[model samples]
Target: MGRAPQKVRNRDTNPCIDEGDASLKCLDEHNYDKSCCSAHFQRYKNCRKYWHSVMLQRRGDGVRPDMPTAAERQELLDAIGGKPY
Candidate 1:
């Protein structure tokens, strides 16, 4: 018989903000100049965008929350076999 799947709970509490608001706050707190602020903001924005996109894709595609992709499976297989791919 198979074991029952585990239940996951939502744990995040921080409110979401747009890229502009986040960057402005980060710049104010860090006292960054225009160029430095822009660069830092861009980095944060890109990271957030990528994370959001991945989350959306996962939900839209109906992928199992814990399932690994082909590349990940291959890596695990290689690791178990003690061989480099």
Candidate 2:
């Protein structure tokens, strides 16, 4: 039997994809050497940190499934790098 289809990584509208898409593509093409994509990890880390705080605030405010606005995502991407190719 064949394996299930793999989900696309770094897809559009994904939080860190704006800044990390190029790094992710390079890493995939180069066999995933961690050092080859440190920037991608860093951008994702920053995005995760911001989202953590956002989710915490949402929970305190009785909100469920906290999601970032497009502007919020763009800000994070700007802080890390430019828009995806």
Candidate 3:
């Protein structure tokens, strides 16, 4: 058997991982039918959008690492005064 969707690791260290995992799970459950997972797709897209904006803002501020690592993300969340997701 293949690995469970929840067990899929985020080696990329990008943001919105939970949304990505949910989309994967939806696709798995629906036999890879994209139409059946539209909501999950939309959510993942929105998450990418939100994080991209944050990345751009940080870049403008001259912060290194346009995309934050996992540990940096928690500091970012604290700095931003709450979690976006």
Candidate 4:
């Protein structure tokens, strides 16, 4: 009988993004160094732009442009049968 084939271990292997060295020939063709091109390094610039938009919206204070006036506040209070303190 032929000997059984050895089982290969997959747990220790790193994915294409985490390898940190360009083992694939195609990345070398594009002059991209895996050590520098990992997604962790490239993600910050995209995230920063999104965060900047969120911060700008927060800085606008929660008031809408067509907000109500003091009369509206009194009407609301009267409807509830009480005035705001």
The best candidate in terms of lDDT: 3
Candidate 4 lDDT (Cα, 0 to 1): 0.42
Candidate 2 wrongly placed segments (more than 4 Å): 1-14, 71-85
TM-score of 2: 0.50
TM-score of every candidate relative to the true structure: 0.38, 0.50, 0.68, 0.27
For model 2, residues 1-85, the per-residue Cα lDDT tens digits are 8997644453332455545666678689879898878877777677667666766787788865465556765686698796432
- Distance from true position, residue 8, model 4, in Å? 43
Q: Which stretches of candidate 1 lie over 4 Å from their true place?
A: 1-35, 64-85
Distance from true position, residue 79, model 2, in Å?
A: 13
lDDT of 3 by residue, 1-85 (tens): 9975653356344778788899999999999999999998988898888889978998999988777877887787799897664
Order of candidate numbers by TM-score, starting with the best: 3, 2, 1, 4
The per-model lDDT (C-alpha) reads 0.52, 0.65, 0.81, 0.42
All-Cα superposition RMSD per candidate: 11.8, 6.8, 7.2, 23.2
- Model 1, residue 40: C-alpha shift (Å): 0.7
Better of 1 and 3 by TM-score: 3
Q: Residues 1-85, candidate 4: write the lDDT tens digits.
A: 8997643332122112222232344367557666755554444344334334534564576644222333553465489786222
